[model samples]
Target: MADHCNGSSHSSESFANIPPIKFTKLFINGNFVDSVSGKTFEAIDPRTGEAITLVSKGDKEDVDLAVKAARFAFDNGPWPRLSGSERGRILMKLADLIEENIEEIASLDAINGGKLFSLCKLIDIPAASMALRYYAGAADKIHGTVLKLSKGLQGYTLREPIGVVGAIIPWNFPTIMFFMKVAPALAAGCTIVVKPAEQTPLSALYYAHLAKLAGVPDGVLNVVNGYGETAGAAISSHMDIDKVSFTGSTEVGRKIMVAAATSNLKPVSLELGGKSPLLIFDDADVDEAANIAFNGMFFNKGEICVASSRVYVQEGIYDKIVDKLVEKAKALVVGDPFDPQVNQGPQTDKKQFEKILSYIEHGKREGATLLTGGKHIGQKGYYIQPTIFADVKNYGRGD
Candidate 1:
């Protein structure tokens, strides 16, 4: 099927302008190309729960190609060989291009990942651009240090780019995470192969296109999209890959660690799960603490790793705080992401929706009080109400 857009003309003045998604293939060596298997998966619109576009499905063969391309670029391409100042210039250009196409990028992210347009436009895009600029500014500043030698000879230590980074980013914050992993690697003159979560691949592929437009060289950045078991495993286990940076579940992080060790003992950085806690004292400002606690857990529909899932309060203020939180959650609109008034949008996909629902069910079965919203909102889309379980023990477990 042909790519569809909202039919608005691409112009600077149009706040709702979004260019049609032109390419859904694997981006390798700075080019959008098809997978070796010739298979594609549907990219869905979470709002409508419908198929939007067909994206190339990459597996081991595609990962191999992407890794080899990245290795070649890191070892011999002009990107690594160029002066740090020159590299910074390219990154700066890319940042400018991202700013120019912020509307399009924001749209793609919302449609592909179920992120709110208002939030992506006002939050994610700006943060991603700033991240690129931050790394660009730091690019030329990395310097080697002269060290004291034990003997008559002089010695110096150099900080070099760890080659061929295998970056696996989650679906919750695709665009921001992409920049977080890619920008620093680019600044340090490292090449990379990115495996964006299958649920949210469009933004990363679109970013790759912008990178090419901004004069990032061929093979410097490659993006492959597929299931975690196949494409993710391939990238993690590739002998040519020197490092792996993963942002996902703790279970999957452990798997990636095992894969990294079994493959070539490559270095791995895992930013895994956190059941973060929030403590509220009797002396603290109730309004301020309630607001902070509300935002912490419900900001991303409670999908964030550091979301304050567990809240501990002094017995005196617990009832008051819970009442205020319930009122706040009730006021929040749960509807279309394009609507600025809506504070909570649909969950990213079915799996996450079910997972959250399961937790709510477990809370109920365990006799924890259901304070507010423990059910689905509407028939269509993956929408879930803002759920809260009070009168719960901190160390409670769920099936």
Candidate 2:
């Protein structure tokens, strides 16, 4: 791997301005309140495996209160009663507010989620702002269908907001996931209760403050920070919730599906975890192909849901591509995300870090040839090498 260099290459701004933790309690009914049980959980920084702050641990009672607030907002508040153009204006203002504090928000995710600081600042924050603006533009354009019957009868359908939404976002991409789920629901005039992942709850809480500043009505947007078993379970099975949106493991998605079905039959939108495949033909340039495959596999420490983890190459150029890939993998710098020279940072949290190591061990025990990397790298944080295996009997699974 390349040697660590100075931090002044890309970002001219100083990392000295990393903001202090301002909000940690559950945001409900346009107020920051403690959980009903007065329980709190640690928000650990994956960079050092240390507690950054103690966040309120919300349970069923907290979820119920948030739901009650959301129901009241949706049923009687001016948020749902407002015109689409008015809603669109408010969302646009929210987007602007996000851009204003983009750097502070980006730093929060980098510390809380172990993501590369430059990536968070340059890509994720901008994408989040654009997502809000994108959905805001659609607010006024939501429409229903008007049909003419065979007998010249007029028929029309109305497009109404789906009531309260429960958003459970994963830790990998906190800011993007928050905006992706939230902007649309707000555009549709729906009240929502958000349950951010425990590992990366800071950014979500900061956003709740910004949403209020941008004129989002109280109870229209509520954020409950806690574990999935308590808060997320309540959201999925709650009777007042109209729908549940989750982005995480497939295992949890299945459970959420069952819970939604057994309850009031509320709908759900799930973005489950899985990997994809990458192919290289003989006609392609071998070096370029290797570079592409390296990025596809190792981006975001290979934590992406649809990452290109499997590779199928044409035999004519297979050997050359493998050699190039091994070379590139070794040269990848794994270190602190704040260091601009580092190509990859630590994993999101300890559970994911050890989980990856176990998978590597499984591949070794199963007799897959270890091609390049398959070991831990750093001492203080959760850092794993960019692992690659070859000649697998299956997709790295043989029993």
Candidate 3:
């Protein structure tokens, strides 16, 4: 692995403004350290096809360490023993820290995840803080229900923190997913062993630092960064993890379920992939529908799982909707995410870039007419123009 570098070689005016980054180690037991195996992996910058930094390459061994720490925290630490109001206060402090460091967090997300800097600054970072704060409020309110049993016998059930949680988040929305998983776990008073997707580990590590600063106790939260097969599988199958939460592809979700089932019969929650469709009726306003569809399908460079890639329109309004959508597609700016003028950025990595291009090729081969974009943007970077295919037919064989 290359030595830690600040990504200073990229000369884009926007890139220059980004804060320097140096923390690339795995966060475990409230400290950043190299992997036990002393291995590191290169984090690629999709915008420039250059190395951003070398992050610790965590595997099953690292997962075990993180999970053990979480288990210890849950079983013996003050975090779980603390009152809900105290926990809430701590989480609220974490939210404040997130807001205080929003710029650096948003910039890390933008540069590392190939996300729009403006969007990260304006939407993702704030949303993360909001999630933490909302969960913080909920922390004090975790309760139970009283039931009137049969024969006039009264009974009540109490809600308690389910031990350690293993959170496996995806690469598409790093900042949001981190809070979506971590905040709730923290609110519920469950210690966590987080396995951030390898592709976007910077913001998560930075978040861990901020979490420590906000007074999250050591061993209450741990982050192990690695590929899915190793760290993720370890978390899913670990006997100590009480719950496994995953957000990613269906294929991986299935594997997680099996691992959970086969190992300890642990409960699992999955937010897997979905096929989103946009339907427009003749009575709907054409321009309004066009803008919504464009935003729905093309936002985040079409990397969203719920991206509205499929469109169905009433016959009477088909031509008008397509014309407006096509015009909107053509107008989308594709370039560096940091550039305020550019609305689109490169694909998150080379694999996703090639995968999207392959799908575009398949769309053409399957007889869909390419209306606006059909090729890549520039010589460097994994960038494809905002592609639009019309006159499409669903010709594929189905299961």
Report the number of clashing residue pairs per model.
Answer: 0, 0, 0
lDDT, residue 183, candidate 1: 99
How does each model score on lDDT? 0.87, 0.88, 0.87
Report the C-alpha lDDT of model 3 over 58-142, residue by residue, as the tens digit.
9999988998888899999999889999999999999998888888887888788889988998999999999999999999899
Number of clashing residue pairs, candidate 3: 0
Poorest stretch of ten by lDDT in candidate 1: 1-10
Clash count, candidate 2 = 0
| Per-residue lDDT over 1-399 for candidate 2, one digit per residue giving the tens place of the 0 to 100 score | 222212111222223356899999999999999999999999887777888899999999999999999999999999988989999999999999999998789889888888888899789999999999999999999999999987869899999999999999999999999999999999999999999998899999999999999999999999999999989999999999999999999999999999999999999999999868898999998878888898889888888998888888888998888888777887787777777778887799999999999989999998988987787764566777777888765545563
What is candidate 1's lDDT per residue for 260-351, written digit by digit as tens? 99989999999998899999999989999999999998997787999998889999999999999988876766766665656766688888
> What TM-score, over all chains together, does every model reach?
0.94, 0.94, 0.95
lDDT for position 282 in model 3 = 94
- The Cα error of candidate 2 at residue 331, in Å, is 1.4
Query: In candidate 3, where is summed lDDT lowest over 10 consecutive residues?
Result: 1-10
- Report model 2's TM-score to 2 decimal places: 0.94
Ranking by lDDT: 2, 3, 1
